[model samples]
Target chain A: MSDTTESKRLTTAQDYASLIDKFDTFLFDCDGVIWSGPKLIPGVREVIAWLRTKGKNVLFVSNNASKSRPMYKKTFDDFGIDTTDDELFNSGFASALYLAKILNFPKDKKVYVIGMKGLEEELDAVGVAHCGGSDPAEMEYMPAKDYTSVTPDPSVGAVLCGFDAFVNYKKYSKAHTYLTKNPGCHFILTNTDATFPSGGEFYPGSGAMSAPLVYSTKMTPTVIGKPNSHMMDAILASKDFDRSRTIMVGDNLETDILFGQNSGIETLLTMTGVTNEDHLLGPKKSSTVPTYIVNSLGDFKVLVDESK
Target chain B: MSDTTESKRLTTAQDYASLIDKFDTFLFDCDGVIWSGPKLIPGVREVIAWLRTKGKNVLFVSNNASKSRPMYKKTFDDFGIDTTDDELFNSGFASALYLAKILNFPKDKKVYVIGMKGLEEELDAVGVAHCGGSDPAEMEYMPAKDYTSVTPDPSVGAVLCGFDAFVNYKKYSKAHTYLTKNPGCHFILTNTDATFPSGGEFYPGSGAMSAPLVYSTKMTPTVIGKPNSHMMDAILASKDFDRSRTIMVGDNLETDILFGQNSGIETLLTMTGVTNEDHLLGPKKSSTVPTYIVNSLGDFKVLVDESK
Candidate 1:
């Protein structure tokens, strides 16, 4: 809002639509750009409908990996929109796909996941065998329950730390002790966010909690979330989308903006979730910047109509 | 085995007893020193018994905060050692205690935790109310999980990150988003071990996974683990222990030796855990060197007797 005229790069939704028409690739943030909280912003469905009418290719890129593709698909359906699993770009799906490609993560690999069902399904889709400590019979899947309980056998080759309800100091301490004792093991984490939005408040995320492990182990995680090319690489390999023709849009800077930057696609910023223009102009703004900005999806229709 | 003649620091068990008699307080690591992989290390029980016989004060300092004092007390009882809740020091406990002391963490203030039951107990002990999303059924207790699933509500004055199983990309992304959104929120963590000795091969610890959150938040966690002095502070606050008459023993360099150095207590390095003597005598050895070194707890006992 400050000094809007002083910038070399201030763009409107129309500019973004023209770029999308030219490039044929689109990426978007979920929370702020398309919707806020659970309610879809105005005109988003219509704008997408217009884009589909124009034969423009689009990929919804989100760093949010909490939900599965099926859930997202359902959400879109509920909103009177059409989206296929192949057309979606989620951090969890991308992460699993990449691990399968690069690390030869086998369908038979006994993956002990500490995440929601979304991640578990992704692993299942990849034919990766996994279990959580909660599954009574699968309790053996967990090696250490942080610092409190040692549930799984400590001899497993890898320990995957994700989002879970049972995270605690005892569990973490146990996990730390186990990992320290066995330095040769593999440690995989989904993302490093400190907190997330729910209902009307924020909650601590994996990033906030996982930071300590990074310091203790001196090992960087094989991050499978946005801004990293692992998910993009997997999406590109799927052949359902063309990389050069795709545009990425989102509200967040690090993941949503950087995803577009990393993928060489058009980026759009919506004033809906997690990020705003002030953040984009702030010092922490990464090397990646969105190609366009719109007040809301309702405004985006105007851009699409003008482009036509 | 290295050239002992050239070493300026004492590097034997006998050297340890003399140093122990000169110190007033003692700290010990839980994982490698007291027990490794569910089994107590050789002669550790005896050495501790000998310490008690000599009227030396002892403190069990662990970076793993997943467990509460009562839990440690049970473990000690299993190990044939008598201990009280105050004698057991964990990062989670210390972090809670320290936050309560400095910030006057309000009894009604909403504390968001990304940890386990032990962490919950600690927060409760300090008279703090917590909110998390993991268990909606616990709504009577504010049924909130960590801050990962929700937005940073202004009502949340403090955010605590610890070991969590539901640590995922969305959570990580959300945590980062919230911290960036609200910079005034107090950020706290249990420990920074890169990897702890999990029962199996090494996996990611809290420190490694929490790196991104720490970076994004631009806040350094007030560590409650060994070497941070929070545990020592807790020990000193107890009526039974005298700070000037205690000592510390462990195998890890950073946790054990560093804890002793930081707390102004004598330190003894055991050759049973994460670090070896080579590291202590290597080029990386700082002025904060251990006062003595021993091969095992058996040798430590002999040194103690000889000093007597």
Candidate 2:
């Protein structure tokens, strides 16, 4: 499904209806497309409900590793949108599921998490014991002069990285030690999103947090998020989905549209978030071209009303 | 001066004497060439003393930004080596000098330091008031949710980074805010050394600390250290020296030897620190070839004794 000149802009209600009819499954990126932050986009809730009424499979795929699936479901519930835990696939949950179910992580071995509580909860839900994340001892600043206190944990089989607020020298020191000292220790990251938008400003994301460990160890991690096939693999493994009938809808082209292109899925770009009009048509436009472009997910509400 | 077969290995006392006589100035990298961590390498003190006795200019040039010149002089004093503050050139000092002397930093504006006391002291020494580095407020972990507290100081004209022990999200966020919000806020770093050796282990260095800001702001800093001409410029500006008659001696080829090569001076590789013999002779040999190689600086003690 290429973005031909005629099909690129879905300005008409008939265009929206026809595009919706083409796909059986819709993968949504939550932060930008459906909502900006705490507030919901005007017509997004109605459009999602309308999609469910049409018996379409709607799944929320997010690179936010700070929140678990259930936590994300709570946010959906608070927003008056009914979303099940099974319908949500976040990077944190994907990382845990990949380690536990796919890699068949040893029960005796533990994972060293350089992330937040959400990643820890996901790992716990999968019965995978973890250390370092939210650990009070690790949160305190440990100087390099006292690095002797940062002893190795032999039981740690994997070092997983995400957006960590308590990222310090100690955490990096221990993670580096684990990757180098432990033979065949797995190095995993949720996503390499360089910057994350929040409170109307961009801040350093998970990729920035993981850079110290990357530099110290000189080892690249297996990234399991958007633009990487691992998240799609986890989603595909959990449910039966046809690639030809699936469409990825997102606001950012780098992670969202690129993820869809990399996964061989059709993509839709919504202009309500990080991306702008010139991002696709500008001189410095990205290679990840979306099949369809819409002003907002709210624009598709016109199609639902027309069908009614 | 290039690495000829005869001068590659200074095995004999006569070879050592000839090599010492070849240069009027000797720039030494402290870590791997002179000593490793708290322990001093054998014969290094004697050779340094012998070089001073020959009326040759001896300068201790290091990328270690964790300590100030006075603090570093204390280390030399502890090692029983008589050295003046003017004889030392470190990254922290270079960064401060680069901003104050070369860049002509605004006297009204302040610098935001994302490093330790050493870097802060250097900045203070130059009459440049700075915030963040070693500041108790910046040391604490500031969560992404409460980024509102990361208020930007409009008076901040620069964000200088080095090997910071207290690197956290707060520092990166504040630096990002300053770089993005302030019109002409400078982004400078002491060095981009990915990792530094300490106690037989490689730890995240200055580059790692600056990465988060680099990722968030998408800005490159003016790096002032080895392998860059800013540090050499500072050295040359402060003292009279003949570039043709000067030689750089270090254990690492990437930084120290590369520094010499980039600065158009002769370089000698010592095998006692971070690099090995195969590093130069193997398939992955660095492009920055050294003019000479020695087993250790201790071998030069033979030359000291021969002079006696």
Top candidate by TM-score: 2
The runs of at least 3 residues in candidate 1 whose Cα sits more than 4 Å from the true structure, single-residue gaps closed, are A1-21, A99-111, A123-130, A133-190, A206-219, A240-245, A282-287, A303-308, B1-220, B239-247, B272-274, B282-288, B294-308
Reference-based TM-score, model 2: 0.95
Model 1, TM vs. native: 0.70
Backbone Cα, N, C clashes tallied per candidate: 125, 0
Which is the leading candidate under DockQ? 2
Please write out the lDDT profile of model 1 over residues B81-152, one tens digit for every residue: 778787777787777777776677766557667666777787777777776524434222112344334455
Q: Write the per-residue lDDT of candidate 2 for residues A192-259, one digit (tens) a residue.
A: 88877777777778998998777767788999999898889878877789999999999988889889
TM-score of chain B of 1: 0.81
CA error at residue B143 for candidate 1, angstroms? 10
Residue A272 lDDT, candidate 1, scale 0-100? 68
The alpha-carbon deviation from the true structure for residue A263 of candidate 2, after best TM-score superposition, in angstroms, is 1.5
Least accurate stretch of 10 residues (summed lDDT) in model 2 chain A? A1-10
* TM-scores of the candidates in the order shown: 0.70, 0.95
